[model samples]
Structure formats: structure tokens, C-alpha cells
Target: MTQPGSTPSRPRRGAGCLQSLLVLAVILGLGYGASKVFGDKDSSSSSASSSPSSASDGKGGSWEVGDCGGPDPENKPDGYRAFDCDDSGATFEALEIKSASILPNAIQCPAGTDLIIQVSRVFGSGDNKKGGGIPTNTVCGRNLTGEHPGDAGAGGGQLVKGDCITSTAKEVACASAGSDAFKVLDLVKEKEQCPAATTEPMELMMAMGRPYDVICGGKV
Candidate 1:
């Protein structure tokens, strides 16, 4: 018999094996916790590294002044990819970058801008496929020296507020005093007609130039 509090007989083989298994389990648990903590940090670092510094350079960022892009052949506003002013497909050039919350009624461009491009409804994709309208209007500008990218140049750009005529070459001849021409109608259905009071109506054309199925009226 063993003496009081004296060492007992050696444990059986199965008992020893059980003790060893418990020690291994504790070690694995600690390792998993440490990995989780470090793994999260690594993931965060990777995300920050891939992000672009400015919206002007980022793939999904808002456009900046002087940026250029356009819609597809179908007249649908694409991703508005930025392109050089001389690029073949580039249609609209950004003149101002307004906050999404505050949009102005008239085209307010910086001095030296010769033309103005107004975007009323910009399309969206993915979950926003149904709608992706900007909070305010996006205005683009160009000089009158060269040809505009899209065919909708007729009646586009800055115009006189009064009566006007648009030509296929994207030139607007206005009879008004002021040199500002904003679109009165946009994106109408095919074959749709202008209002009765409209003295001069311009047909919308393809590309970013003019809205579809619509007409623009002005005074000379």
C-alpha cells in the first residue's frame, strides 16, 4: 500500500496518451488565434496599397476638370473613361467638378471655355442598373477651334439664348444676344416631336453630342 500523499503507481498507457492529446489541443488553439490576428492586418495593408490616391486617376472615381470621355456608339453613357483630348472616341471634356449635392441651373464654366456639355441623366450598372443619376449636372467644355468628338455637336456648346439653327456639322447659329445655349429638351423617344410653342427645334443625334428623340429650341 502507498503511504499518505506518497507517489501512486505509474499511470496506465491509455492515461498517458490522453494527457499528451490535451497538451496538443491547447497548442493548436493558441496558434489559430495568433494567425487570425496577423492575417487581418495583412489583408488591411493589401487593400490600402491597391487604392488610388486621387479620383482623377482611379478607375471608379468622379471625373475632374479637363478629363475627357464619352458614351458608346448606341449613345449610352459608358464608364466615362478618361482619354486624351485628341483621342478619337473622346467626346466630352470636363470643365467643372461640382459637388454631387449642389448643382447649378446654368452652365457655370471657368473663363476661356468656348463650349459647354451638359449631362442630365447618367446611366448606372450592377445593382444601380435601374438608376445612376448624378446629384447635380456635369458640365464639360471645349474650344471652338476643332471638331467635336460626337455628332451631337449641332446645337451643343454655348449658344445664344434666343432663336437658333443647328447643322449636321454640330454648329449652332443663334439669333439671341447672350452666348449661352442650354438644352431645353433631352432624350425624347424616337419620332417624338417638340412642343407647339417651340419656334426652332433641333433633332437629337447619336453619341454624347445631343439627347435622343428630342429637340432643342432657342431664340435669336
Candidate 2:
């Protein structure tokens, strides 16, 4: 991820090694802007409990878990509109909800989280009552079709140098010998820098909001 005031680094060229880079495509395709402040602001050392209840965006709109939503082009009071997860217009799937008071600095998402949505006004849970007050909440979710970077472990891993990638753009173990698996020999800054044996010089478009482009795969 691109941190404020920090230069973005390239993916490693070593075998089975990669830097953790969470790709945020929402900003580019869905009009969902990303903030530089992504770290957890919660003071508690323990993890907060999950809330599946409904929450308001202070604009009379409410949402709950298992819901898929995207920004409303009409600029409705909800600011966002819900859609079926199978719908092509759906951007993200809500996975968890937490109190905003716990996150004073930044919104903390779950391990597999790809997006974060914070509501300035909450209801039916936490400090907010049925009438609604100043209490707030944060929603963590995963992008419906965004790429996952680095070794996300059980969550999911994205394509990186030294990884064996499938035609579908999934990162698989290097040991998996198959026609679909292609080993990434190198990661270069430009397409021209790729080795002569390179077959697929896929350019990582604005990964983590990096200033420059990243071309993956080449012959050793």
C-alpha cells in the first residue's frame, strides 16, 4: 500500500518473495477515493467485536452485512446504493462492521479486507439510539473484482515476481507444474526492460496508487 510521504517500491525479484502491496482499484474504476490514512486508530490492544446490524450514513441511508453496494451516481441521500453480489455494478461486499469511536485515527479492516466504508452516523447499535445521534461506525469489505497483491495467505494471493501465475491472473505455488502455471522470472519498471524471453509483460496499473507502472515476468 502507498503510505503518505513514502516512495513506492517494486515487487521483489527473488524466488517466492514479494512485498505486501494491497491493490485498490476502486479509486480508478468505481469513483471510490482512497485515503492515505489506513492504519488502525483503536487504542485497545484487543480486537473489536463485529456488528452485523444496520448503520446510517447520516443521510437517512442504512446498510447491513451481506450487502453489496456502490456509489450512487444520482447523488442520493444514501450516497451509495445496494446491489446484488452477482450484479456487475456491485463494487464491494460488506464483511464486518465496528464502532467508529474505536477508530479515531484510521479504519482497520479484516485480514482479507480490500475496502473500508465509514459512516459518520449510526443507529440500532453502539452509542446511537433509534432516533440516531452522533455515534458512528466503520464497514470493512472486499472488492468484487480487484486484484490482490502479495502473499495474503488463506485470504488470497495476487500475481507477483517469483510467483507461478495462472492464465486467470491467480498466483499459485511454484511447485505446481502445469501448463497453466507460468513462473515470473522478473519484475521490471518498463516493458522495454523485460528480458527477451518474456512472454507476458503484464503492466500493473496504478497498483496501490504507485506513481509509476510495474511490468511483471521475464526470462531469467
Candidate 3:
């Protein structure tokens, strides 16, 4: 028989140290298994939540025909799109809903092809893409800023580097001055990219977030 709350084991008058060591090893093994299970759950949930969500009315972001959309980003209703991305005391202008990707920096694909794009249009994520509380371009497109030489327009940490994320219609916006908004008429693939579109599929999930409303050709 064994003492209460104790495992049955061969009794050795002078083996306390050895038994204690074996008990410790068993405890450690059990802890290791528990930690592995818990760690896996955490990793999976974080991976899923961090992944971008599917654009409603569409998944991945191919704006369907008749889908409520703006005009070709190049051509804005008032003229060209404009916005002051941050109050960083930097005086520069650009269009909204454009993912901060301008021509030359934007990915160019053949017209009338099916494309899935990403949008920084997620609101309540704190008006920025670093997944923290930073502004959009400041967070995502600084590398591509015209003011900076050798720009690659990379910011918005919410997105993996070099992934496709926004879209625009190639319509020409009459050049305007001192505005903070514009619109993209049809969906143009948006991403500060290398060459062709991305072959990877971004996962989507329902989020307790809002939409990012910025002007494209006119208004988003």
C-alpha cells in the first residue's frame, strides 16, 4: 500500500533523492505537453485574426460590375484626388482609397482581368496600418514618398510587405490642387508591388471593425 496522495512505488530506505528526481521529470513532461497545446491554439488564433478580411459584396476585392465604385483614380470628379495623410507638418497631397500607391509605384495589369486586391479601408483599426495607431502612408508608403529619394512606398504594417492590397480605375483625374480626397471609379488592383499580381491567397474572417472611407476619383 502507498501513503495517501502518493503513487505506489518500490520502497527503498535511502532513495528519497532518486524518487524526487523521477517525480520532477514526470511533472516537467506533463507541463511540456500542456504548453504545447496552449501555444498551438494561441498561434492559430493570432494567425487567423491577423489575416486580412474578405471585402463584403465581394471576397478578396474584385469589384463586380455595377458594384458601387468611384471613377478612374487618375480622373477625379473635381479633378485629381487629394489628402493630407498625417498632420506631421509635412505638406504633400495624394488621393484616398488608393492605398497610397501612385502610378509608377502601383502595379499595372492588363485591363479587364479578374483581380483580388487588399484595401486599407479597414476603419477603427485606428486610422493606420501598422496595426498600431499610426497614419496610413506614414505607416505604409513612406518608402515610396516622392519627397524621399529611392522610394518603394512601403508602410501599413498591417499588411505583409510586398503583398497586394488596394485597387484603382485607370480613369484620368483632372489635376486638382489642395484637396484631401478622390475616388477610384472601377476597381484597380492596389498594391505597392514588384511586377505582376500576387499568387498568394490572403485569408478572410469577420471582424468587429468599420470601413475606411477615403475619397478616390471623387468620394469613397
Candidate 4:
């Protein structure tokens, strides 16, 4: 059974619209195990109160909900870069941004979120700097144009358990139960946890240097 607070099992359709920005990992040595974002207003311990926008040079200057983008290759403090949905470089779509600590579970992400990343914002002069460190936040995203394991193809869709895919690399209803359809057996942090019959292991990458989330699937 799907966990009560976990992402919904239904596969999310791919979007081709150009979307917003994402996480750029800044290793904070504060021992709080968090990543840092630039130009944030929250205190060191809380989540973001607003969505992330690029304060630097990148596509579409500022980010908003439903925008597509990811970590900037330049790796600046405001390292996230926005991208047009049709651009192959656009990897993720920002679904939710909140003032919260980085967590590994799906709760931080929206129901259809396929990726999770955390970022921090440092308090500047006159800004609240409680706890004496940078403020961190969780950025929930959906996989749109990036690559994943199992050769699921670009913008294949969400890889939740019980989801099904066809040989043509299209997501389908598991209830259809066609002989050629592949059924998602489970989603695990490691490939070793997949059942012996599992044929394909799709690796979903996360931000903030977290481990990959693997989706195990096989013939129906």
C-alpha cells in the first residue's frame, strides 16, 4: 500500500512548457546537514516562505511555480538556472518551494513530485539570522526532460509503484494489464531491494547530493 503521506501512485504526464528554477548544492559546514540557497529571507532553521527565483543570469530571470530548470552549471550561490520546457537541458519542473529543512521523504514534494532537493538562504545585514547559520528550504520538482535509468525516454512520466509502461515507452494504466506492459514492482533507494523478477531499474536523481531513488519494474 502507498503510504498515507507519500506521492500518489498515478503517473504524471510530461509537460513541454518552459518552466522555472531549481537547487544548486552549497555544502554548509554548520553540521545541520543542509544545502544553501542565495537571497533567501528565512532564518537558519526554517523552510522557505516563497518559491525560488534566480538572482543571477539564466533563462527567464525569475522563477515561479510550474517553471522548468535545475542546478546551474556555473554553480553560483544562486546556482539554479531556468530552462524552456522544450530544451533538453531543462531537467526538472519546480512544483513547490517552502521554508523547511531538507528531508528525504515525499512529504516535502507535491503529490506528483518525482524529485526532491533542499536549498538554503543566508541572512544578510538587518535580516533575521537566528541560530547563527543559513536558512534552508525544500524544493519539490517533477522530472520532465532529464534522463533516468531504464531508458524510460525523455519526459516519460512519474515512476511510482504500480504504474505501468508499454514497450513504446509510454505510461499506461496498470489495470489494463496487457501482456506487453511493464508493471512497476517497487520504488527503492537501492537497486538491491528489487524483486528477482524485476527487469528494469529506473534511477531517479535527487538534489542536495542525496542518493538516487530507484524504481523497479518488470513485465506484467
Q: Report the Cα lDDT for residue 100, model 3.
A: 23
Ranking by lDDT: 4, 2, 1, 3
Better of 2 and 4 by lDDT: 4
> What lDDT tens digits, residue by residue, belong to model 2 across residues 1-220?
3321222232222211100111111211111111112332122211122222333333444445655655544433233345556655566666666555433223334334544555444335333422224434555555555453222322122223455554433444455435754556555557787767778665553434332243344332
**Number of clashes in every candidate structure?**
12, 0, 32, 12
Give one digit per residue, the lDDT tens place, for model 3 in 1-220.
1111222221112221211110000000100011111122122111111122211111112111111111113222211111223323222221112222322113222211111122322223222222221112211112112322101112111222221122221111123212332232222222222223333222222122212111113232
After superposing candidate 4, which stretches have Cα over 4 Å from the reference? 1-22, 25-63, 76-79, 83-89, 106-108, 123-133, 146-220
- Candidate-wise lDDT, in order: 0.30, 0.40, 0.19, 0.44
Show model 1 residue runs off by greater than 4 Å: 1-59, 73-80, 84-86, 100-106, 110-127, 133-137, 143-156, 159-220
CA error at residue 2 for candidate 3, angstroms: 80
Model 1: ten consecutive residues of lowest lDDT = 22-31
Write out the backbone clash pairs for model 2: none
Give RMSD (Å) of candidate 1 vs. truth. Answer: 31.5
Please give the lDDT score at residue 209 for candidate 1: 21
- What is candidate 3's local distance difference test score? 0.19
